[model samples]
Target: MKKADLEAYRQRLMLLRARLCGDVSALAKSALHGAAEQGGAASSMPIHMAELGSEAFEQEFNLSVMETEEDAISSIDAALRRIEEETFGTCTGCEGTIPKMRLNAIPYAPMCVRCAEQEEAH
Candidate 1:
């Protein structure tokens, strides 16, 4: 990849990493604390059993989203490393040049579409 393009992607990935880090922190706080953190809606005594269930579900959902965001952050980190190594747009699987359209859509993609599909199939 060109030096200028690599720098641009690096900047974008850094911004994404920063944003996702904040998201993960927020999700962790909300998931771990639940209603207690949200304006003291929680009490020493539990509310309704159904509300407890809902809180559990919400915590689980937040944790799930955090995991997804964490994975994306990892990918962004790997992409930044690849950029530093001068292999940003190259497919790690097939060693082909990944298309610009694909890169534009997913700047942190490690492989081309075909390789990605194959990887997913396995």
Candidate 2:
């Protein structure tokens, strides 16, 4: 890719990172509020079946969101470091050139599709 394209991807990565961080933070705050309103760890046992279901759903949803946000943050950080080291868009596992189209779709990707699928398979 051209230098300009790399810079553009960098900007996109930064924006994605910022957004993910904000989302994770917000989810964490919401979880904390919910936990607090339940009156501490001693009161974790829901008084009613409905209350249990709601809390379980919210906790599971927040956990999923947090996991996704964490992955995004890690990917963005790795991409930024690669950009600095002049290796952005290169597959970390196989050192292959990542297609520009893929990079455009996922600016923080650290591996090409083939390498990524292979890695996941193992």
Candidate 3:
């Protein structure tokens, strides 16, 4: 890849990392500490069992999304390291050049479309 392209990707990746980090932190706060801790009215005890179940489900959903965001953060970190090591825009699975479109859509993608599809098939 060209030096300018590499730098641009680095910047995009950094921005994405920052955004996801903020999302993960907020998710952690909401998921781990109930809404009361986040400036909401203290309603730790639900008046009905169904409300308690709904709250549990919401917390679990937040945790699941938080985990996915954390995984994206890890991938972004790896992509940044790859940039520093001069290996950006190359597929880790096949060492093939990842198209600019894919990179533009997903700056931290580590595989080409073909390889990614194949991996998904398996």
Candidate 4:
């Protein structure tokens, strides 16, 4: 990759990392506050079976979202490391240059389209 392209990817990756970090922090705080409120309300009031089921479902959904966000953060961190190592935009799976379009779409992607599809096929 050219120096300019690498620098651009670095900047984009940094911005993405910052945004993901902020989002994860906010979601964590919100989840904690929500759980606390729900717990207090449940203790003070006679909650019906349906309400309990719904709250449980909501908590599960939030947990899933947090897990997904955490995975993204991990990917972003790895991509940042790749940039530092001067391997950004190179597919780890195939040792090929990942297309610019794919990089533009997913700056944290570790593999090219072909390798990603093959991995998914397994």
lDDT of each: 0.88, 0.87, 0.90, 0.86
Write the number of the candidate with greater lDDT, choosing between 1 and 3: 3
List the candidates' TM-scores in order: 0.90, 0.88, 0.90, 0.88
Model 1, position 3: C-alpha lDDT score:
88
Q: In order, how many clashes per candidate?
A: 0, 0, 0, 0
Q: Which candidate is the best by TM-score?
A: 3
- Sort all candidates by lDDT, best to worst: 3, 1, 2, 4
Q: Give the top-scoring candidate (lDDT).
A: 3
Instruction: Please list the residue runs of candidate 3 whose C-alpha ends up more than 4 Å from where it truly belongs after superposition.
Output: 35-43
Candidate 1: misplaced stretches above 4 Å? 35-44
8-115, model 2: which lDDT tens digit per residue?
988998888888899999999998888787777755668888987899799889989899889889978989999999998788989989998999888888899999
Instruction: Please write out the lDDT profile of model 3 over residues 30-75, one tens digit for every residue.
Output: 7768756435555556778898788889988998999999999999
- After superposition, which runs of candidate 4 have C-alpha atoms over 4 Å from their true positions? 41-46
Cα RMSD (angstroms) for every candidate in the order listed: 2.6, 2.7, 2.8, 1.8
Q: For candidate 1, lDDT tens digit of each residue in 20-66?
A: 99999999887767656544644554568887677778888998999
lDDT at 83, model 1: 92
